[model samples]
Target: MELVDLTTTPAEALPLTAFKAHLRLGSGFADDSLQDDLLAGYLRATLAAIEARTGKVLFERVLQWRLSRWAEAGHQPLPVAPVTAITSVALRNAEGGVSEVAVALYGLERDTHRPRLFAKGATLPAITHDGEAVVSMTAGFGPSWDDIPADLQQAVLLLAAHYYEHRSETNGAVRAMPFGVVSLLESYRNIRVLGARS
Candidate 1:
């Protein structure tokens, strides 16, 4: 996979827990009442976006499917969308050192520049090249919809879907950037993406 540092982030990345999980999963805070599942449900409806982007299964099964209007219609069960995901994979011994693959993806309601975040689970690492500035960069694939295995794809997609739901609801009060998905693909040799809409 060809990795590119779209834009570098700070080395001091936040913890995965700090990012939102699919709200439909209950916010990990309470059982139900307190939180709303709408945010997560909305993201779940757009699972196809996964294949369209990386051509992989970024989610698991319908268990995590969002409770939405479309969902009420009843089709064949679908996977969830991503809220946050990784975009880098690590190579243990390569080129006299370690190598990483970076990824980036985004979705839009229309023609606006909005990257719909996806990956619900991901660990963003602090990257810095031997340049002048010590910028934390990430790299991976492109606006994919590529191909990955089944089980692994499910895991990635599920996480993305979950995160999308949670993040959407929490960030509703304030307009936040599309969530980000960063992952180590190709058995940790390639970096892949599936983040909240960018």
Candidate 2:
């Protein structure tokens, strides 16, 4: 299975100003924007790490997931969560032939954690011999930083600040996420039971 990000988060959608404020950096200075890029890098890394740990998308974007076979006959769980829509689905043969699946055949089951693509009928279309199925989707809380849940937004800031403070640390010891950040992300995580499909 392979998952790809089809669209990137726009710079304007990032909470740069808010992050700066959180850091309490001086304003109205000649070199005030000098650390902007560096700070942005930390923010991006923090967002990615939090999303990976929680299996959620912090910003709205398009994604494409490719798989060799369906997880189930009529329903296939999505790898990420808060999916807003299923853009398209297609099957590609080993010989490079592609066939588009009709949108009417399947629908998106919007779930906060384990979203799925479910067939309207008995089962989804089959993939040909040595072929793969590609599912395109849009997933995330929303496009703007303000669209994110308050707890999640606070978590991002906290983690990013941690990264910023440890930017120059040379210690070889590993570090774990702060307890506050972890607590904030706890509810967003997907807890799978034993023998569960997801």
Candidate 3:
């Protein structure tokens, strides 16, 4: 992850005060709801159910919040056209191995899918040992994850934007992002809002 200027964001990107309180409030909403192994099984089952119903992974919708801020700072408005989100990044190890990493955005909504890489619905599939995302093609999602700093978060958005712009529907699978993905990662605006608040 590269460094982005911390001078152009709002006073609070995430409302930690509210978030903590919310977590406390919701802590016991599902007590004993999931046993460890049962929870793991449930996670798998949930992913399967989601894919069977939607044709895409749950992760695509999850990554919208992170990218939206970057979009707001720049000319782009997080939800461009009909694009939903970054989903997760597909990665390739130096050895040529492949895997998928689910991008975690902010809160997710039901009944609607975010426009993102795996929006078409997919099984959780195989994640690499490092938890990088796996795309059908040889896209190197690992590089994005390997060096992901808050700054590089924008690269993910830019890269996704580029993907949507150049997407070809002829194929059933998503394609790799262009090399300029590096440049896209560099677009995070500087934010002085943090210091001002302090």
The candidate that wins on TM-score is 2
Native-referenced Cα lDDT, model 2? 0.92
lDDT values for all models: 0.30, 0.92, 0.32
Better of 1 and 3 by lDDT: 3
- Superposed by TM-score, candidate 3 places the C-alpha of residue 48 at a distance from the truth, in angstroms, of 1.0
Backbone clash count, each prediction separately: 57, 0, 31
Reference-based TM-score, model 2 = 0.96
Task: Order candidates by lDDT, high to low.
Answer: 2, 3, 1
Global Cα RMSD, each model:
20.1, 1.3, 21.5
Expressed as tens digits, the lDDT of each residue in 1-198 for candidate 1 is: 121234422222211222234223434455543333443333333333433444333322111111212111111112212212332234333223554434332111111112222222242232234211111221122223232344334444454555554553764532322333224233422233697322
Better of 1 and 2 by lDDT: 2
Candidate 1 TM-score to native: 0.21
Instruction: Estimate the TM-score of every prediction.
Output: 0.21, 0.96, 0.19
188 in model 3: Cα distance from truth in Å? 30
Error in Å for residue 173 of model 1? 15
lDDT of 3 by residue, 1-198 (tens): 221112221223322232234224344556533333333332334333323333333222222222212222112222211223233345555466754454442212222223223222333233334333332211111222232344333333443344344445666443444555434423332223654311
Candidate 2, residue 101: how far the Cα is off, in Å: 0.1
* Per-residue accuracy of model 2 over 81-122 as CA lDDT, tens digit each: 899999999999999999999999999998888999999999
Model 3 worst lDDT window (10 residues): 135-144
